[model samples]
Target: MRIARLDTPAGPRHAVALGDRWHVIASPFAAPLVYTGDSIPADEAVLLASVDPRVVVGIGHNQPGHPLPMQAWHKSVHSVAGSGDDIYAVRDVGTVNIEGELAVVIGTSATNLTLENAFEAVLGYTVANDVTNVDQCPIDQRNFQGKSGKNYTPLGPWIETELADPENVATEVVINGAVVANSGSFNLPSSVAATLVYVTKWLTLEPGDVVLTGAPGTDLPVQPGDTVDITLAGIGTLSNTIA
Candidate 1:
């Protein structure tokens, strides 16, 4: 099932994809989603970020030549934006790069988890653009200033509740009309379950929390006018403009 947060005439609403319509739901975090029977045409509803994450955890060093250990960082929750939002460039930060990554959304509180059961806490999967500005702070070091810029993380289209093999999911990044990166979750040096276990070892992930599985070898600097489209097979595309 594809779950989405949409802008309805009443306000923001949680919805489940039902054919050509968005069936209103009580909440995406609700166990056995409760449908409200109210629906809007899929083409008419505006999409919001898959979830309003309270904490956004980012993983680094999952790429080669970085390190064997997983490097994690905290980003401001306010940085989250919907698919059609603009990723504003911090003038002082100089160059801004876009890294398309597979994002894991937490459905339940998790702590001291093991790889064997790490997925139990997952709500679903969404696409995230881990926008970076290296000029604000180095990627290898603490990135409080670098990773927390307003509206830097663009996530959505919707969340896919089922994924047979997340690691095998293919990802592609396109800028303007040209394809810039062709990669997949399979390229990550570490698996999703292992990364979740690593994170839950210390930090407790709560519902609406987001974990950004690192984007490898696909980050590219963008200009103000560039439009980026990131697509993960089985999941939908997340597109945003650089401004």
Candidate 2:
């Protein structure tokens, strides 16, 4: 099932996708989603971020040539935005880049989890656009810019409840309607489940927490007029304008 948060005439609501329509639900963060019986045409309802994670944990070093082991960091919740939102770059920064990644949403609170059972805490997966602002010229190691600002992290379209093979999911990064990066979750050295286990060992991940699985490769920089679309199989596309 594809679960989403939507803007409706009645107000914002949690919904489930069926066919081309979305059925309203009670709670998106809750397991065994309860339907509210109200329905909306898929195109009519405004799509919001798939999950309003209280905290977004970004993992680095999943890509190659990183000197350190895999690392995780906390991003301001204010950085979260829906697919249609604009990602504003810090003024005078003169640098903004994008990373199209697979985001793992936590369904249940978990801590000290082992690899054998970490997947259970995962609610589902969604597309994440890890937008960043390069500090300045002469950028080198230790300059991770996850703190770029609001609109940095765009997540949504919806969440897919089940993924049979996390590693095999295909991902594409599209800039201005062109496919610039083609990759897969398998590019990461470790499996998604293993990454979850590794993260949980250090911090308690609450329900609605998000874990970015890292980008497939070094992506091109985006400008104000450009639209970046991050697409993941099973999960829908997350599109955002750079403004």
Candidate 3:
């Protein structure tokens, strides 16, 4: 089932998309209930980030071309941004930037999970815009600090449970109507299973936690008023406006 969070007249509510309309799942945006009948067309609804995870983990340099030591993964951290929020261009910082990537949601508690059992931990998949401010530090440090700007991580459109091989899907980013970053999951240096294993070794992943697989190529910079479209192969697209 495809699940999403949306701003409704009542308030923020969880919903499931079916055909051209959405079924209210949960109410009050906290714990939702599935509402059947009376569908609302997807286009008319204001889609919000699928969830506000307690922890929003990110992978650094996980792509093939930017391979780094596993220990360097400490630089990876949790980041968050609201849907349709403005991402600032840190002028004081040297070169602020943004990257688009595919994000995975944990369905169950994962502790020291093995590759064989990793899929069970996965709840669904979504699109993410991992915005960074790269100008102030060295290339290595850039991945650490610049990547975790407040309200810099935008995720959702919705979560899809039936993503054909979530670990090996295609992801792309469009800026102002132009494709900027495009790559296949095959380009990743570490498999999703490996990442889960490595991450769970230090942190216990909860049901709502999210992990953004690293971007594949050079970063893109967005100024105020620019729209970023992040798309995943099986999952839907997440569009956010930069301010």
For each candidate, what is the lDDT?
0.88, 0.82, 0.72
Backbone Cα, N, C clashes tallied per candidate: 0, 0, 7
Number of the top candidate by TM-score? 1
**Which of the two, 1 or 2, has more lDDT?**
1
Following a full C-alpha superposition, what root-mean-square deviation does model 3 have from the true structure?
3.7
Task: For residues 1-243, write the lDDT of model 2, one tens digit per residue.
Answer: 788889888877879889889999888776577888999998787998888888888877634676767887887778888989988877677667888888998988999878788888988999988777755525734434535477888889888888777777899888999899899888877778778887888999998899988776835688789988888887879999888
**Tens digit per residue, CA lDDT, model 1, 1-243:** 899989887888889998999999998888888888899998888999988889999998545576467888888888999999998877766778899999999999999889888889999999999998877655537877777777899989898989887778899999998999999988888888888998999899999899999986668889998999999999999999998
Per-model TM values vs. the true structure: 0.95, 0.91, 0.84
**Model 1 clashes, total count:** 0
Error of 2 at 135 (Å): 3.1
Q: Model 3 over residues 90-163: C-alpha lDDT tens digits?
A: 56666667777777788878889888888788888777777877664476553566766665788888888788
Candidate 1 pairs with clashing backbones: none
List candidate 1 segments past 4 Å from native.
62-68
Could you arrange the candidates by lDDT from highest to lowest?
A: 1, 2, 3
Highest lDDT among the candidates is held by which one?
A: 1
